[model samples]
Target: MDDIFHFDTLLAGPPDQLLKAQEQERQRIAADLHDALGPLLTLIRLELGRASELVREDDLSDLAVVIGRAHGHVAQAFDELRRTVVNLRPAMLDDLGILPTLGWLVREFERCGSGLRIRTDFAVTEQAVPSHLKITIFRICQEALNNIVRHAQASHAALSLTLTDESLCLAIDDDGCGMPDNSHRGRGPAGGTSSIPQRATSSGGRCDITSGPGLGTRIHVCWPLAGIRP
Candidate 1:
Protein backbone atom coordinates (compact mmCIF):
# COMPACT_ATOMS: atom_id res chain seq x y z
CA MET A 1 0.00 0.00 0.00
CA ASP A 2 1.07 3.58 -0.61
CA ASP A 3 2.32 5.30 2.54
CA ILE A 4 1.32 8.77 3.73
CA PHE A 5 4.37 10.23 2.05
CA HIS A 6 5.22 10.43 -1.63
CA PHE A 7 8.12 8.54 -3.21
CA ASP A 8 10.84 11.04 -2.44
CA THR A 9 9.52 11.91 1.00
CA LEU A 10 9.26 8.26 1.97
CA LEU A 11 12.81 7.53 0.84
CA ALA A 12 14.16 10.69 2.42
CA GLY A 13 13.65 9.81 6.11
CA PRO A 14 11.71 8.13 8.89
CA PRO A 15 8.10 8.86 9.70
CA ASP A 16 9.06 10.95 12.73
CA GLN A 17 10.95 13.31 10.45
CA LEU A 18 7.78 13.93 8.43
CA LEU A 19 5.51 14.68 11.40
CA LYS A 20 6.63 18.31 11.58
CA ALA A 21 6.10 18.75 7.86
CA GLN A 22 2.62 17.23 8.12
CA GLU A 23 1.70 19.57 10.97
CA GLN A 24 2.97 22.56 8.99
CA GLU A 25 0.70 21.60 6.12
CA ARG A 26 -2.23 21.41 8.51
CA GLN A 27 -1.42 24.88 9.84
CA ARG A 28 -1.32 26.21 6.29
CA ILE A 29 -4.75 24.76 5.62
CA ALA A 30 -6.09 26.29 8.85
CA ALA A 31 -4.71 29.67 7.86
CA ASP A 32 -6.29 29.47 4.42
CA LEU A 33 -9.68 28.73 5.96
CA HIS A 34 -9.48 31.19 8.84
CA ASP A 35 -7.56 34.02 7.22
CA ALA A 36 -8.87 33.89 3.66
CA LEU A 37 -12.15 32.05 3.05
CA GLY A 38 -13.84 32.69 6.40
CA PRO A 39 -13.38 36.47 6.30
CA LEU A 40 -14.46 36.67 2.65
CA LEU A 41 -17.73 34.84 3.38
CA THR A 42 -18.41 37.06 6.38
CA LEU A 43 -17.76 40.11 4.27
CA ILE A 44 -20.18 38.94 1.59
CA ARG A 45 -22.91 38.37 4.18
CA LEU A 46 -22.31 41.78 5.72
CA GLU A 47 -22.43 43.54 2.36
CA LEU A 48 -25.64 41.72 1.39
CA GLY A 49 -27.31 42.77 4.63
CA ARG A 50 -26.08 46.32 4.16
CA ALA A 51 -27.37 46.41 0.61
CA SER A 52 -30.80 45.22 1.73
CA GLU A 53 -30.99 48.10 4.25
CA LEU A 54 -29.65 50.66 1.75
CA VAL A 55 -32.18 49.66 -0.93
CA ARG A 56 -35.07 50.23 1.50
CA GLU A 57 -33.63 53.56 2.69
CA ASP A 58 -33.21 54.68 -0.95
CA ASP A 59 -36.98 54.05 -1.57
CA LEU A 60 -36.19 51.02 -3.74
CA SER A 61 -38.64 48.83 -1.82
CA ASP A 62 -39.39 46.64 -4.84
CA LEU A 63 -35.72 45.74 -5.17
CA ALA A 64 -35.46 45.38 -1.39
CA VAL A 65 -37.42 42.12 -1.41
CA VAL A 66 -35.09 40.62 -4.03
CA ILE A 67 -32.02 41.80 -2.13
CA GLY A 68 -33.52 40.44 1.11
CA ARG A 69 -33.94 37.04 -0.49
CA ALA A 70 -30.34 37.07 -1.64
CA HIS A 71 -29.29 38.01 1.88
CA GLY A 72 -31.20 35.06 3.32
CA HIS A 73 -29.46 32.68 0.90
CA VAL A 74 -26.08 34.07 1.86
CA ALA A 75 -26.94 33.66 5.54
CA GLN A 76 -27.73 30.00 4.98
CA ALA A 77 -24.49 29.54 3.09
CA PHE A 78 -22.55 31.17 5.92
CA ASP A 79 -24.01 28.80 8.48
CA GLU A 80 -23.10 25.82 6.26
CA LEU A 81 -19.53 27.03 5.76
CA ARG A 82 -19.06 27.53 9.49
CA ARG A 83 -20.20 23.97 10.10
CA THR A 84 -17.75 22.74 7.49
CA VAL A 85 -14.94 24.64 9.16
CA VAL A 86 -15.83 23.20 12.55
CA ASN A 87 -15.81 19.69 11.18
CA LEU A 88 -12.45 20.24 9.51
CA ARG A 89 -10.90 20.83 12.94
CA PRO A 90 -13.25 20.73 15.87
CA ALA A 91 -12.62 23.76 18.10
CA MET A 92 -13.98 21.88 21.10
CA LEU A 93 -11.01 19.55 20.99
CA ASP A 94 -8.96 22.39 22.39
CA ASP A 95 -11.66 24.22 24.29
CA LEU A 96 -13.43 21.39 26.15
CA GLY A 97 -10.92 18.56 25.95
CA ILE A 98 -11.47 15.00 24.59
CA LEU A 99 -14.06 13.37 26.83
CA PRO A 100 -16.89 15.76 26.05
CA THR A 101 -15.92 15.82 22.40
CA LEU A 102 -16.29 12.04 22.16
CA GLY A 103 -19.65 12.20 23.88
CA TRP A 104 -20.73 14.93 21.48
CA LEU A 105 -19.62 12.83 18.53
CA VAL A 106 -21.71 9.87 19.64
CA ARG A 107 -24.78 11.98 20.23
CA GLU A 108 -24.35 13.82 16.93
CA PHE A 109 -24.02 10.57 15.00
CA GLU A 110 -27.15 9.18 16.61
CA ARG A 111 -29.03 12.31 15.57
CA CYS A 112 -28.08 11.73 11.94
CA GLY A 113 -31.30 9.62 11.62
CA SER A 114 -29.51 6.85 9.78
CA GLY A 115 -31.62 4.36 11.76
CA LEU A 116 -28.42 3.17 13.42
CA ARG A 117 -28.35 3.08 17.19
CA ILE A 118 -24.87 3.34 18.73
CA ARG A 119 -24.45 2.46 22.36
CA THR A 120 -21.38 3.96 23.93
CA ASP A 121 -19.53 2.97 27.11
CA PHE A 122 -16.77 5.27 28.24
CA ALA A 123 -15.21 3.74 31.31
CA VAL A 124 -12.05 5.77 31.04
CA THR A 125 -11.71 9.14 32.68
CA GLU A 126 -10.47 12.14 30.72
CA GLN A 127 -7.60 12.60 33.16
CA ALA A 128 -6.44 9.02 32.67
CA VAL A 129 -6.12 9.30 28.91
CA PRO A 130 -3.26 11.19 27.32
CA SER A 131 -4.08 14.11 25.07
CA HIS A 132 -2.51 12.61 21.96
CA LEU A 133 -4.16 9.25 22.56
CA LYS A 134 -7.56 10.89 22.81
CA ILE A 135 -7.30 12.34 19.34
CA THR A 136 -6.26 8.97 17.97
CA ILE A 137 -9.22 7.29 19.64
CA PHE A 138 -11.64 9.89 18.33
CA ARG A 139 -10.35 9.57 14.77
CA ILE A 140 -10.55 5.78 14.84
CA CYS A 141 -14.09 5.86 16.17
CA GLN A 142 -15.14 8.42 13.57
CA GLU A 143 -13.77 6.45 10.63
CA ALA A 144 -15.13 3.11 11.89
CA LEU A 145 -18.63 4.48 12.31
CA ASN A 146 -18.49 6.10 8.90
CA ASN A 147 -17.55 2.77 7.35
CA ILE A 148 -20.29 0.93 9.20
CA VAL A 149 -22.95 3.41 8.12
CA ARG A 150 -21.83 3.43 4.50
CA HIS A 151 -21.20 -0.30 4.08
CA ALA A 152 -22.42 -2.47 6.97
CA GLN A 153 -26.14 -1.73 6.63
CA ALA A 154 -26.39 -2.54 10.29
CA SER A 155 -29.22 -1.31 12.48
CA HIS A 156 -27.31 -1.33 15.76
CA ALA A 157 -23.73 -0.73 16.86
CA ALA A 158 -21.86 -0.53 20.15
CA LEU A 159 -18.68 1.31 21.15
CA SER A 160 -16.72 0.48 24.27
CA LEU A 161 -13.67 2.28 25.64
CA THR A 162 -11.91 1.40 28.85
CA LEU A 163 -8.59 2.12 30.46
CA THR A 164 -6.37 0.26 32.87
CA ASP A 165 -3.31 1.43 34.72
CA GLU A 166 -1.29 -0.07 31.91
CA SER A 167 -3.32 0.26 28.73
CA LEU A 168 -6.51 1.40 27.05
CA CYS A 169 -8.84 -0.70 24.93
CA LEU A 170 -11.49 0.34 22.43
CA ALA A 171 -13.89 -1.77 20.43
CA ILE A 172 -16.71 -1.14 17.99
CA ASP A 173 -19.16 -3.84 17.02
CA ASP A 174 -21.99 -3.99 14.50
CA ASP A 175 -24.75 -6.45 13.62
CA GLY A 176 -24.47 -6.04 9.88
CA CYS A 177 -23.09 -8.27 7.17
CA GLY A 178 -19.47 -9.29 7.68
CA MET A 179 -16.47 -8.30 5.63
CA PRO A 180 -15.35 -10.19 2.55
CA ASP A 181 -12.98 -13.12 3.06
CA ASN A 182 -10.22 -11.19 1.35
CA SER A 183 -9.99 -8.91 4.39
CA HIS A 184 -7.57 -10.16 7.02
CA ARG A 185 -6.51 -9.37 10.57
CA GLY A 186 -7.38 -5.82 11.55
CA ARG A 187 -7.44 -4.59 7.96
CA GLY A 188 -10.45 -4.78 5.65
CA PRO A 189 -10.37 -5.08 1.88
CA ALA A 190 -11.98 -1.70 1.42
CA GLY A 191 -9.75 1.33 0.95
CA GLY A 192 -11.04 3.32 3.92
CA THR A 193 -10.82 0.27 6.19
CA SER A 194 -7.04 0.28 6.10
CA SER A 195 -6.84 3.56 7.97
CA ILE A 196 -8.15 1.98 11.17
CA PRO A 197 -5.15 -0.27 11.65
CA GLN A 198 -2.76 2.32 10.30
CA ARG A 199 -3.92 4.87 12.84
CA ALA A 200 -3.67 2.38 15.68
CA THR A 201 -0.17 1.33 14.75
CA SER A 202 1.03 4.87 14.33
CA SER A 203 -0.17 5.59 17.85
CA GLY A 204 1.59 2.56 19.36
CA GLY A 205 -1.49 0.43 19.59
CA ARG A 206 -2.68 -2.96 18.34
CA CYS A 207 -5.91 -3.39 16.34
CA ASP A 208 -7.87 -6.60 15.80
CA ILE A 209 -10.79 -6.89 13.40
CA THR A 210 -12.97 -9.99 13.17
CA SER A 211 -15.87 -10.83 10.89
CA GLY A 212 -17.22 -13.57 8.64
CA PRO A 213 -20.32 -15.17 7.12
CA GLY A 214 -23.30 -14.74 9.47
CA LEU A 215 -21.07 -12.84 11.90
CA GLY A 216 -21.07 -9.05 12.10
CA THR A 217 -17.84 -7.05 12.13
CA ARG A 218 -15.93 -6.07 15.27
CA ILE A 219 -12.87 -3.84 15.57
CA HIS A 220 -10.80 -3.91 18.72
CA VAL A 221 -7.81 -1.73 19.58
CA CYS A 222 -5.52 -1.81 22.60
CA TRP A 223 -2.89 0.76 23.45
CA PRO A 224 -0.42 0.68 26.30
CA LEU A 225 -0.80 4.14 27.71
CA ALA A 226 2.72 4.23 29.02
CA GLY A 227 4.00 3.80 25.50
CA ILE A 228 1.79 6.36 23.78
CA ARG A 229 3.61 9.25 22.11
CA PRO A 230 2.85 12.84 22.99
Candidate 2:
Protein backbone atom coordinates (compact mmCIF):
# COMPACT_ATOMS: atom_id res chain seq x y z
CA MET A 1 0.00 0.00 0.00
CA ASP A 2 2.85 2.36 0.77
CA ASP A 3 4.31 1.79 -2.69
CA ILE A 4 1.00 2.64 -4.37
CA PHE A 5 1.17 6.39 -3.69
CA HIS A 6 4.55 8.09 -3.96
CA PHE A 7 5.25 10.62 -1.22
CA ASP A 8 5.95 14.17 -2.31
CA THR A 9 6.54 17.03 0.10
CA LEU A 10 6.37 19.58 -2.67
CA LEU A 11 2.73 18.71 -3.26
CA ALA A 12 1.53 18.96 0.34
CA GLY A 13 3.88 21.09 2.36
CA PRO A 14 3.98 24.84 2.98
CA PRO A 15 0.86 25.87 1.11
CA ASP A 16 -1.38 23.43 3.00
CA GLN A 17 0.14 24.46 6.30
CA LEU A 18 -0.49 28.10 5.47
CA LEU A 19 -4.12 27.31 4.67
CA LYS A 20 -4.46 25.47 7.97
CA ALA A 21 -3.05 28.40 9.90
CA GLN A 22 -5.42 30.79 8.18
CA GLU A 23 -8.34 28.55 9.14
CA GLN A 24 -7.21 28.53 12.77
CA GLU A 25 -7.06 32.30 12.74
CA ARG A 26 -10.59 32.38 11.34
CA GLN A 27 -11.77 30.19 14.20
CA ARG A 28 -10.17 32.55 16.70
CA ILE A 29 -11.92 35.52 15.16
CA ALA A 30 -15.22 33.61 15.24
CA ALA A 31 -14.74 32.91 18.94
CA ASP A 32 -14.08 36.59 19.56
CA LEU A 33 -17.25 37.53 17.73
CA HIS A 34 -19.23 35.12 19.88
CA ASP A 35 -17.61 35.90 23.26
CA ALA A 36 -16.97 39.64 23.10
CA LEU A 37 -19.67 40.95 20.82
CA GLY A 38 -22.41 38.59 21.95
CA PRO A 39 -22.57 40.02 25.44
CA LEU A 40 -22.21 43.57 24.17
CA LEU A 41 -25.19 43.08 21.90
CA THR A 42 -27.23 41.67 24.75
CA LEU A 43 -26.29 44.67 26.92
CA ILE A 44 -27.32 47.07 24.19
CA ARG A 45 -30.64 45.31 23.76
CA LEU A 46 -31.27 45.47 27.48
CA GLU A 47 -30.45 49.13 27.75
CA LEU A 48 -32.51 50.12 24.74
CA GLY A 49 -35.69 50.31 26.84
CA ARG A 50 -34.66 49.62 30.42
CA ALA A 51 -36.74 50.97 33.33
CA SER A 52 -35.24 52.12 36.63
CA GLU A 53 -38.25 52.57 38.95
CA LEU A 54 -40.97 49.94 38.79
CA VAL A 55 -43.42 51.86 41.04
CA ARG A 56 -45.47 54.65 39.34
CA GLU A 57 -43.90 53.64 36.05
CA ASP A 58 -46.23 54.28 33.11
CA ASP A 59 -45.66 51.34 30.75
CA LEU A 60 -41.91 51.35 31.59
CA SER A 61 -42.25 47.97 33.36
CA ASP A 62 -43.77 46.45 30.24
CA LEU A 63 -40.96 47.90 28.15
CA ALA A 64 -38.37 46.40 30.54
CA VAL A 65 -39.96 42.97 30.23
CA VAL A 66 -39.87 43.21 26.47
CA ILE A 67 -36.22 44.29 26.54
CA GLY A 68 -35.42 41.42 28.91
CA ARG A 69 -37.01 38.94 26.50
CA ALA A 70 -34.98 40.40 23.67
CA HIS A 71 -31.85 40.05 25.76
CA GLY A 72 -32.70 36.38 26.40
CA HIS A 73 -33.03 35.80 22.69
CA VAL A 74 -29.69 37.50 22.14
CA ALA A 75 -28.10 35.24 24.72
CA GLN A 76 -29.46 32.17 22.92
CA ALA A 77 -28.08 33.41 19.64
CA PHE A 78 -24.70 34.04 21.25
CA ASP A 79 -24.55 30.46 22.55
CA GLU A 80 -25.40 29.01 19.15
CA LEU A 81 -22.80 31.25 17.52
CA ARG A 82 -20.19 30.17 20.03
CA ARG A 83 -20.93 26.53 19.25
CA THR A 84 -20.32 27.31 15.58
CA VAL A 85 -16.95 28.81 16.44
CA VAL A 86 -16.02 25.80 18.53
CA ASN A 87 -16.99 23.50 15.71
CA LEU A 88 -14.74 25.47 13.38
CA ARG A 89 -11.57 25.20 15.47
CA PRO A 90 -12.23 22.74 18.31
CA ALA A 91 -10.00 23.88 21.20
CA MET A 92 -9.82 20.25 22.37
CA LEU A 93 -7.71 19.32 19.33
CA ASP A 94 -4.84 21.38 20.71
CA ASP A 95 -5.25 20.48 24.37
CA LEU A 96 -6.38 16.87 24.18
CA GLY A 97 -4.72 15.65 20.97
CA ILE A 98 -6.18 13.70 18.05
CA LEU A 99 -7.90 10.69 19.61
CA PRO A 100 -9.71 12.64 22.30
CA THR A 101 -10.39 15.41 19.85
CA LEU A 102 -12.06 12.95 17.49
CA GLY A 103 -14.11 11.61 20.37
CA TRP A 104 -15.33 15.11 21.12
CA LEU A 105 -16.02 15.71 17.46
CA VAL A 106 -18.07 12.53 17.26
CA ARG A 107 -20.07 13.57 20.30
CA GLU A 108 -20.79 16.90 18.69
CA PHE A 109 -22.08 15.11 15.63
CA GLU A 110 -24.36 12.88 17.65
CA ARG A 111 -25.80 15.96 19.36
CA CYS A 112 -26.90 17.36 16.02
CA GLY A 113 -30.10 15.24 16.07
CA SER A 114 -29.11 13.57 12.82
CA GLY A 115 -29.51 10.05 14.22
CA LEU A 116 -26.06 9.33 12.78
CA ARG A 117 -24.33 6.65 14.78
CA ILE A 118 -20.59 7.13 14.35
CA ARG A 119 -18.57 4.23 15.66
CA THR A 120 -14.88 4.89 16.14
CA ASP A 121 -11.93 2.52 16.37
CA PHE A 122 -8.76 4.43 17.19
CA ALA A 123 -5.62 2.41 17.88
CA VAL A 124 -3.13 5.27 17.76
CA THR A 125 -1.71 7.29 20.60
CA GLU A 126 -1.06 11.01 20.97
CA GLN A 127 2.56 10.48 22.02
CA ALA A 128 3.27 8.49 18.86
CA VAL A 129 1.74 10.80 16.19
CA PRO A 130 3.55 13.94 15.03
CA SER A 131 1.94 17.35 15.53
CA HIS A 132 1.39 18.04 11.85
CA LEU A 133 -0.04 14.59 11.28
CA LYS A 134 -2.37 15.12 14.21
CA ILE A 135 -3.76 18.28 12.65
CA THR A 136 -4.19 16.57 9.30
CA ILE A 137 -6.04 13.64 10.79
CA PHE A 138 -8.29 15.90 12.82
CA ARG A 139 -9.13 18.01 9.81
CA ILE A 140 -9.85 14.91 7.76
CA CYS A 141 -12.29 13.61 10.34
CA GLN A 142 -13.89 17.02 10.75
CA GLU A 143 -14.50 17.33 7.04
CA ALA A 144 -15.69 13.74 6.84
CA LEU A 145 -18.37 14.33 9.48
CA ASN A 146 -19.41 17.56 7.80
CA ASN A 147 -19.91 15.65 4.58
CA ILE A 148 -22.02 13.04 6.32
CA VAL A 149 -24.19 15.68 7.93
CA ARG A 150 -24.66 17.64 4.75
CA HIS A 151 -25.13 14.90 2.17
CA ALA A 152 -25.13 11.37 3.52
CA GLN A 153 -28.61 11.13 4.93
CA ALA A 154 -27.34 7.79 6.18
CA SER A 155 -27.84 6.50 9.68
CA HIS A 156 -24.51 4.79 10.35
CA ALA A 157 -20.90 5.88 9.95
CA ALA A 158 -17.61 4.55 11.26
CA LEU A 159 -14.08 5.94 11.64
CA SER A 160 -10.83 4.19 12.39
CA LEU A 161 -7.22 5.29 12.87
CA THR A 162 -4.63 2.58 12.77
CA LEU A 163 -0.86 2.95 13.16
CA THR A 164 1.82 0.50 12.20
CA ASP A 165 5.59 0.48 12.48
CA GLU A 166 6.08 2.58 9.34
CA SER A 167 2.75 4.21 8.47
CA LEU A 168 -0.58 5.51 9.71
CA CYS A 169 -4.01 4.79 8.22
CA LEU A 170 -7.20 6.80 8.56
CA ALA A 171 -10.46 5.39 7.28
CA ILE A 172 -13.98 6.77 7.20
CA ASP A 173 -16.92 4.65 6.09
CA ASP A 174 -20.49 5.78 5.62
CA ASP A 175 -23.54 3.82 4.52
CA GLY A 176 -25.07 6.60 2.49
CA CYS A 177 -26.33 7.10 -1.00
CA GLY A 178 -23.06 6.94 -2.90
CA MET A 179 -22.02 9.05 -5.87
CA PRO A 180 -23.88 8.81 -9.12
CA ASP A 181 -20.82 8.43 -11.32
CA ASN A 182 -17.08 8.93 -11.49
CA SER A 183 -17.48 12.02 -13.65
CA HIS A 184 -19.14 13.74 -10.70
CA ARG A 185 -15.86 13.63 -8.84
CA GLY A 186 -16.08 16.85 -6.90
CA ARG A 187 -19.87 16.76 -6.77
CA GLY A 188 -20.19 14.03 -4.14
CA PRO A 189 -21.54 14.79 -0.71
CA ALA A 190 -17.98 14.43 0.45
CA GLY A 191 -16.88 17.63 -1.20
CA GLY A 192 -13.85 17.47 1.05
CA THR A 193 -13.05 14.04 -0.37
CA SER A 194 -11.35 15.68 -3.33
CA SER A 195 -8.74 17.17 -1.02
CA ILE A 196 -8.08 13.99 0.94
CA PRO A 197 -5.59 12.78 -1.63
CA GLN A 198 -3.66 16.02 -1.52
CA ARG A 199 -3.56 16.00 2.25
CA ALA A 200 -2.17 12.47 2.24
CA THR A 201 0.28 13.10 -0.58
CA SER A 202 1.68 16.17 1.14
CA SER A 203 2.21 14.22 4.33
CA GLY A 204 4.11 11.38 2.65
CA GLY A 205 0.95 9.33 2.17
CA ARG A 206 -1.84 8.38 -0.27
CA CYS A 207 -5.64 8.55 -0.29
CA ASP A 208 -8.14 6.16 -1.89
CA ILE A 209 -11.89 6.33 -2.23
CA THR A 210 -14.55 3.72 -3.13
CA SER A 211 -18.18 4.58 -3.74
CA GLY A 212 -21.00 4.26 -6.29
CA PRO A 213 -24.78 4.45 -6.62
CA GLY A 214 -25.62 1.99 -3.86
CA LEU A 215 -22.30 1.05 -2.36
CA GLY A 216 -21.44 3.04 0.75
CA THR A 217 -18.54 5.46 0.55
CA ARG A 218 -15.20 4.54 2.07
CA ILE A 219 -12.23 6.85 2.32
CA HIS A 220 -8.82 5.46 3.13
CA VAL A 221 -5.69 7.54 3.54
CA CYS A 222 -2.28 6.22 4.45
CA TRP A 223 0.96 8.10 5.04
CA PRO A 224 4.41 6.78 5.72
CA LEU A 225 6.03 8.32 8.76
CA ALA A 226 9.52 7.37 7.67
CA GLY A 227 10.80 10.40 5.77
CA ILE A 228 8.17 13.07 6.44
CA ARG A 229 9.85 16.49 6.29
CA PRO A 230 9.00 19.24 8.72
Give the per-residue lDDT of model 1 (tens digit) for 74-139.
Answer: 676677667766666578877887778877888888888788899989898878778778778887
Model 2 TM: 0.70
lDDT of 2 by residue, 7-34 (tens): 2324343446546755765877777676
Per-prediction count of colliding residue pairs?
0, 1
Whole-model lDDT per candidate: 0.69, 0.71
Query: Which pairs in model 2 have colliding backbones?
Result: 12-202
Candidate 1 weakest ten by summed lDDT: 1-10
Q: How does model 1 fare in lDDT?
A: 0.69
Residue 75 in candidate 2, Cα distance off native in Å = 3.0
